[model samples]
Target: MLHTIKQYFNRKGLRDPEYEFLFEPYTGEEAVSFDCETTGLDVHHDEIISIGAVRIRGNQILTSEKLELFFNPQQEMRVESIKIHHLLTCDLVDGVPLEEGIRQFLNFIGNRPLVGYYLEFDVAMVNRVLKPMLGITLPNRQIEVSGLYYDKKIAAIPQGNVDLRFDSIMHDLDLPPFAKHDALGDAIMTAMMYVKLQHIKYLEKF
Candidate 1:
């Protein structure tokens, strides 16, 4: 585990202490908005089935540069999970092996900060595979869209913070509604949220 962690830090360019603060005061040329679909929600027990991400630059989502991958999980899928991600065991027949999926995901993300709603879980799932399969971990800085939305709301209205639910934020921002539970759809929603949050005046100051 220690070796894996060390290797991850090295691979992600997170060896520098300053890198820890990279996502706090967001300043960057590009940021990758990400989301994932999993077999279940328990990070300790469940497994990731698919991952999707899109890079945002200059207030635009670079759709042409998106990354989407289906992963073969070591565990069997729970029936309930199918309602969410729509990935049945049969659907994953062509899924990539864990190591290849991790490597592709890492290559896609590179050193850029990762953005997602509830990102820690996705990061943990990725780490689970990386540490065991490749003796590495995912070390990229993470930005949670939920937190960003809450911060933006607080800044906009000094009275009180609003709920960070995805639906709430989408309704508030007037973003086009889409069916949830799909990785690509969620990633696109996250990208839209990130753009909308950036336009918030108080958030722009930072």
Candidate 2:
């Protein structure tokens, strides 16, 4: 864990004493399932349009308490990107600035372990904004839902190939589908997946 933290800082060209708290071990019980809607796929150029997350305490997903924040990205919306998330510049005119949006997200998540389908991309987009403001990427540990599903599946069928698609996983687990391409809906669905995966006998034995 320490090695990963050092590598992240070195790659990002950052050094800060106050941000060291992020490297400490996480002892909390809560985990946040999060998702981000961005302008495009290029992390270096695209900016976040929204962030949604829900918290899980043990096996329960606290849907009542969730973060759904929108931001005004000062960039032209791509036609393809607009088709994916359906948010245009005009739709985000009244949204908060990136700085305020990020601050609120950080406050909502704190040090809780983060869970998501493909978390690295989301984390990278978040860190792109956070590195400049906080001098650190997310300090919280991240748990990929795909990884959890893979572990459980491979255990059940040692030599069988596993399907890791979001829809496939949800279907296999008997979970209902939620609205895709929407941050809040996706976050809640991901949260549900995490809770269910935790109760699997294979995971419980470990």
Best by the TM-score measure: 2
TM-score, per-candidate, Cα-based: 0.80, 0.86
Give the local distance difference test score of model 2. Answer: 0.84
What candidate 1 gets wrong by more than 4 Å, as runs, is 1-28, 156-161, 202-206
Best by lDDT: 2
Provide the lowest-lDDT 10-residue window in model 2.
Answer: 10-19
Model 1 error, position 3 (Å) = 18
lDDT against the true structure, each candidate: 0.77, 0.84
Per-residue alpha-carbon lDDT of model 2 for 57-109, expressed as tens digits?
Answer: 99889998899998888898788888978888888888998888887887788
lDDT of 1 at 106: 70
